[model samples]
Target: MPVDLETLYPKLVNLLLDPVFVVDESGNIVFVSDACESLLGYTASEMIGTLIFDYLHPDDRERTRAEANRVMTGHPHTNFENRYLHKDGHAVHILWSARWSEDDKLRIGLARNVTSLRRANQTRDALYRISEAAHGADSLRGICDGVRQVIAELFPRNDLHLAFYDPVRTVLTVPDWSVDRANDWVEGSMQPGTALAEVISLGQTLLASRDPSQPGLGVITESGLKSPGPLNWLGVPLISNDSVLGALVIESQSEHIRYCAADQELLQFVATQVAIVVERKRAEDHLRFLAHHDPLTGLTNRSLFYDRLETALKSAGRHNSLVALLYLDLNDFKQINDTLGHEAGDQLLIETARRLEQCTRETDTVARMGGDEFTVLLTDISDLAAVDAAVGKIREVMAVPMMQEGQIVLISFSVGVALYPQDGRTARHLLGSADSKMYEHKRRRQAG
Candidate 1:
């Protein structure tokens, strides 16, 4: 005997892997197939009485509703896509085919889960954004900002934190955060036992959510030690060439939202790209520093000195102010190098550089012009008395004895002064005048 059509139709719908749904004009789910349990993590009984729009991802709701209206107006929708919130709190990408039944005054739809395909596309877009940031950004901070923007799209929250590791100090410093509000973790160091610290220490990804059995993550703040307020945290180490540079962190304050393994994997991919960009930027910065600084004393080099002197001269000209240039050479520095050793001579130079730095104001530029010759540019000097005071302070600091190889070594400076627009207008001319006067002072001291 042949089976009846109504019984066979219901059996065929039950066999479909994709979920089929019938909804009233009010958007209430009147019928849902058993496949909904597998596709949305919701049983048919639980979804039957709920509004279809209630399960949609908040960001995709308006567009989905607009499409629903079209379908109810006798138009058939095919391949219409939107995101629905799964029962497990993750987004499920869905493609739908639906049409309205005028006689029954209901809408019938079939939903095909396309979450994996959508995620692949999202990953591609995210990687493209990171690549653009790496090559287009002018500074490390710009690259970080770009990465933060891409991450915000994926996590869609305001509590993201990015902590950078200082290899020399073995510490993690939070450099960027999404939210503007003050939190203990912003611009602060990550302490031991915190989620960020643990990720850095283990060089792995970690996910922490509200669990009474698990210990709370701790943080150090100005107020004191504190635990992170009820939130879900995910952290992934930024690793490059077997070294962990830092961590990328995502935080969710909503009790309903929790990070899963898939989120961790996506963030890890982003972190890898970030580490590469950061390493490249750091190398570029080191090269730039070496180009403008003295390797021995860590002071500004001759090139940098000339650049600053020229800048100061321009500023002085604009304001009709005075700029004093001081030329200094250690007295008998070569003799010290010959009597003692190069190592001892180096130690003396380093100490002298420190004393010179301490004698000048922060606005002054002090540079080592090869060997024991150094230059100081003091800008915005009010009068001759200010110049004399600065020179006198330098003399006093140079008189202090420096220890070299467990022995006391006395050092002094043969100094000369020149004023902008008075001794010379150009940097080259002023530098020459200072050098000539320095030699004159040295000869007078030797004669005396």
Candidate 2:
């Protein structure tokens, strides 16, 4: 039997995966294949009579129109790219191979949906930038700012929120850039059932909408969103080493916007990188704190104290002012440590450090030189009377009784004072003189 080529040709065109479009010189859709419905959510019958420009995304219309005009001028374009509005309203990226046919007075075009490919490229670029942010940023805030900028480029007109969980405090903290409901919502506990909370606690990506069937799982309605339409939210947990550290959330309230499955996947991937960076930065900060601080008392350590004392001596030399060093030995600290457990001894030491800090000015430096022994660097001393007054204040504050391990305990300091230039010139000489005087005072008390 002979075949009818005309009938078979339409069937063959419809069988192709990519949609074929035929628009007249006036830019009206004269013919479209059935495959377009799969790519655009619009049936061929509905699209045939509509203006082709009607489907072009508003942001891409100007460029797309220019391309169309060039094609109508007898130029064929194979690599032109633009965005078209899907029937459901999200953007559909289209790559075109098109030409103008003078005989038919029609513009023939083939469209390949490149939305997924374009998103993949964007994700790759975003990941590289985020990694740079992690390595180059000096602080947590800087890192977050960089990440927010990269994310904003990927999803424009969307609000981004980063909620971090403080495992020690059991609180969720949002950075300052967060907007409206997220700022308010993230302040408290990561309570169960909340959208963000669920993302972190369950270590899962969540897609929520105003649709009743997909209930936002306690999505905050009073988010103060100014847009007048259904709200949509996508949250992905930032997980590191199998632990849920926080959540990265993007929200939109525009009727035309929706958070789809691809968005959820991409965000989740990006959040993994974010969690690693944040965790690394926090660890670096903690290590830096430990290096300069006493672990037990949270005061400056011996090494930092010496550096400050040397700096103070140089400054006092230039200013012609006297600096004093006070070496303090806790009275019978060992006896207390023996009577009560080490934990109670630690509490006493922490309390003593606080009291010592309270007695010193902000300009002075307080340090723990190991084993209930501490040193204070006093700067800008006027004369001997000023030094005496500072010593008197320390004695008065230390005389108060403290409750430790359900027992009333009294603590005092057998303090030794060393004046700059008068006792010794250098930091080592000053420390040696102070230590000798402290032992002398302790021995006198024992004799008395």
lDDT of 1 by residue, 294-362 (tens): 999989999999999999999999999999999999999999999889999998999999999999999
TM-score of each: 0.86, 0.80
RMSD of each: 4.7, 5.3
Worst 10 residues of 1 by lDDT: 213-222
Q: In lDDT terms, how accurate is model 2?
A: 0.86
As a TM-score, model 2 comes out at 0.80
Whole-model alpha-carbon lDDT for candidate 1: 0.84
In model 1, the clashing pairs are: none
Q: Whose lDDT is greatest here?
A: 2
